[model samples]
Target: MKLAFDRGRRTRAATWVSLGLTFAVALVVELTFADSSKADSPLDSKGDQGNSQVERGRYLARAGNCVSCHTSPGGPAFAGGLALNTPFGKLYSTNITPDPETGIGKWTEEQFARAVREGVRPDGAHLYPAFPYTAYTKLSDEDVSALFAYMKVVKPVSFTPPENEMGFPANQRWALGMWKMLFFDEGRFLADSSQSEEWNRGAYLVEGLGHCSACHSPRNFMGAEQASMAMTGGEYTDKVPSGEIRTWSAPNLTDVPNGLGSWPMEEVAAYLRTGRNGFTETHGPMNEVILNSTRHLSEGDVRAMAVYLKSLPGNVGNIGKAASAQVIEDGETLYNVNCGTCHQPTGLGALSEQAGAKLVGNPLVQASNPASLINVILYGPHLAKLPGPKRWKDMPEFGSKLSDDEVAAIASYVRSAWGNVGGAVTQEQVAKQR
Candidate 1:
């Protein structure tokens, strides 16, 4: 009885100590993040703040790719109607406009910065991970301030965002406090002495304001990123704006032999500048990036990004497997039987008579999974929506005719055949989209 009592007492003491530590840490963090001072900016002066503020805001929006989540296709900018699907549930984006109630009209710079960098809203509600604060945490205070300044001057949106479609347990915003504790780190880019100025700048953009990690990083079971394996992506899923099912396997961005290491700098720049490279095309999440974020960047910035990505060290020793025989064989046979008409045996589809796309050299063949290939086969890629590419390959939707397994097989075949190097597509992957 005495020993049991002592053990219970020890456990209670430990709990108290843990709670005390958490409180102290939280206080330190809150104080450190607090801005002790600020000058009267143009927004504080109570007016339009001039063309410069608006233009600066536009740049900040572009840098952050605000349109990616906030603006639905053919919808008003920052309207907050986009619905993001996640493993836990669906999260609807909020209006960032300056409307007094529905929009951010009442939000101070502090509120905006906290939302952007810390994933907390004006009312102190936690935001869904879809907001990508993990990457935004690295944004400089000055940039955050500039972004808030810009949003304030924009047209106010009177619209209220749709409710988050999450169910019970997952809908609890307080859970994110635990999530943030595990994943969130408040820090800025620290330049390495060994790298060049251009490389460092690229690193800052890709790792910071751009939130490339949102797409590229693999998430833990709790939806936190496994940071050690930074850009070697795992499974990610979504639906395109057109209501066709879409999923993604954010490919490894590190400079492994089969990863970004194979691509030349010019090819990387071309893909970033335009939507297409002779080797592959961007779709799904990357399509948003090209249409909104990357393509709009300066050529110098694009090249710098390419350089920085290329300069990354080879992957850690642990790597996934090559395509299996069963997967490869079934996939190849299906492609030949069904896909030969358009994509052909070589994986080269007739994108256009003069402008053709090669499947062997294509990025789709080398993606981390069969999601893009399956998506393209189900719903043709929309490469022509932007300025970069005039011509694109459009495969007819095979959803009605093809079984999920058949689609998986074909994707698996394409990935393994014709010098392509990526993981095999299981029926499980195909089933997730269907």
Candidate 2:
């Protein structure tokens, strides 16, 4: 009986050992195949990889506005050094050129895709949110591979930007893993079956690569955009041409009183392509968008974006009430004195390129919130430097010449004049912005 019990114990031990070996072998095989599968994706498969791929990638890069953030003012394209200001501190953009030591020349295709889509470096460090990989995560594997192919062939420059400056916990890159866990979702875009093909394409670009909400959507104290109030409006800092940093608010883009609710889709497309559409001229960051990105896009894409944007519902209760009679009369006089020569007495701006923007039926002039109008009047337009035909003439700044009350009057007049029902501008608002 003792001998039989000893044999039973040994047999059980042998069974357990066999099960452990099988599990270990299975894990090894799974890990090996997983890595190999990623490397051998259809997107990474060898094919006609030459001029066409590079050209397509170039278009995609332009659509993504890679150069705007990556290229510093007066710096070599893609060499990087652009300072991105955050509430905590400044973070410098990285060089994306093909330089072996400085740029991404040594990275494998899989590594490049991982960085673009997953915000993870080859060494497995989490990238800061400033990289916009949250939006890029929706990019398809094929598009990422194409971008990688294009980046690999770009003019390589041996340059490194300064290290990012953040205080304490904000500077720790490892902390981003937690941030991603909360906010980031890793996946490619899926076309909505319910939407039209054009709408779907536009939605993909806007929600993913364009990341328009980064600036347009309000953020909480944690720096995450408020998805609930998307495209409603947000305030950001912009450097004026005179080197002074000014607080500028991106106006609501939704179909509401203060937003793009009244704008025609065609006009929106025209504005994106040319920076002007007889309503308002693009300035500041938007100028850069037109110069570096949107202007280069196909007309179809621009139309698609316009269509998608126009479909958004605006805030119903956000509309401003009409101004008092005395305020309107006071504003008209100011408009006549300061703006009549350029914009004409009737508020129908001159047709000449050197003249002022048209006020009649102009969306910017009729916006419920007059922040953009005040900004343009105070700081003037900063024309984007681009290699193309001129879009719009520059406007002069009135900050030095006009008092806060006077600027408010002119803005109020424009908003209320010529069948426009936009509300009055306030001196207090003007003073705060100044």
Candidate 3:
């Protein structure tokens, strides 16, 4: 009986040992294969790469809107000194140059792909979502290759930007790995066979590579976008000193009653490419996007984005239009009293381009999103270093000049009379902002 009991104990011990060994082996396999840092570069010289590859890379850069994030204010394009503000803290943009020390210059194509597709740098660091790899995860392997190809040729900037500023519990960088475990799924885009090539291209640009929704979409308390309300305007502020109060909201993009619904596709494309539509010149965060990224895109690419925006399928209420009887009467009276000297009764404020400001079809008039209009009304934007003060977006601040009621009245009239959605505005909302 003693011998039998000893034999049975040995068998149980053997079973436990085998199970542990199996688990260890399985973990090794999973970790090795699921390693996301494999986006290293293919060892090809700039001169060795095909001309088409380089050209395509340039196109992809524009489509992905890389410059918008990397470029510094009053600095070289893609030179990488921009600061991004988040609820957790402020994070600066990094250099994407070929510089060996300061940039991704030495990373192989595989390493670069991992950074773009998986938000893990070649050095095994997790990138902040402010880099927008959430949308980039959908980028095709071929396009990711081309983007790396283009990045390899650019002049490398040697300066590393500032470190992230966050309060305790938020400053922990490794915590992002857990965040990724919850949010990221590195996968390629699956096209719907029924859609036109144009539509597919548009979807790629808007949802996958361009990441327009990062700024345009509203976020929950967790900082993740509310996908259902994608691009439908929300709160934002510039990431500069004390980060200028972004009391001026981002307007909704698909609220037809409030956003680009009344505008035509051609105009949208034109605006994206040139930073101007008959109604308004791009300003606020949009101005940076245009000047850095969209303006560099191909006409075809711009058209594709326009088409996608027009096809959003969901609609929100317009918050810019204010055409009620009281609002319009007050607006016209205010315009004639304060603005008639320069702008005509038609509200087609003309542009001098070389001289003073114009008040014409500024998106404020028909803004479906209230942020742009409210910003201009409350804070008044500056002309900055641009060539002309003649732009309509360069309006002076009227926060001190107009009462909350008056500002609401003028904004209401402008939004409604110009074929706007006629959304109502309240004096209380304006006062709250002030």
Instruction: Write down the TM-score of every candidate.
Output: 0.80, 0.79, 0.74
List clashing residue pairs in candidate 2.
none
Rank list by lDDT? 2, 1, 3
User: After superposition, which runs of candidate 1 have C-alpha atoms over 4 Å from their true positions?
Assistant: 1-50, 240-246, 316-327, 337-356, 361-363, 388-393
TM-score winner = 1
TM-score of candidate 2 to 2 decimals? 0.79
lDDT digits (tens) for residues 205-244 of candidate 3: 9888777766566665445666777777555555211235
Model 2, 121: alpha-carbon shift in Å? 2.6
Model 2, 95-208: lDDT tens digits are 988789999989999999999989999899987666778788999988888788877777777899998776654566775676577667899999989989999888877888
lDDT of candidate 2 at residue 140, scale 0 to 100: 90
Query: Using alpha carbons, what is the TM-score of model 3?
Result: 0.74
Backbone Cα, N, C clashes tallied per candidate: 3, 0, 19
Q: How far is candidate 3 from the true structure (C-alpha RMSD, Å)?
A: 12.9
The lDDT leader among the candidates is 2
Error of 2 at 426 (Å): 5.2
- Candidates 1 and 3, the one with greater TM-score: 1
Off by over 4 Å in 2: 1-50, 316-329, 344-350, 360-371, 384-394, 412-434
Across 1-434, the per-residue lDDT of candidate 1 in tens digits comes to 44445887886555544433322112100000011111112233344656676666667677667766676445567777776654335567778877788988888888888888888997888776677777788888878887877788766657877786765556667867876776678676688889899998888888887777666666554556667877765455555435643555566677764467668888888888886775666665566667667777888888988888887766532234665798788888887887776667877666663433567645445656556667767665544355544454454577778998888788777766766666677778777766
- Arrange candidates by TM-score, highest first: which order? 1, 2, 3
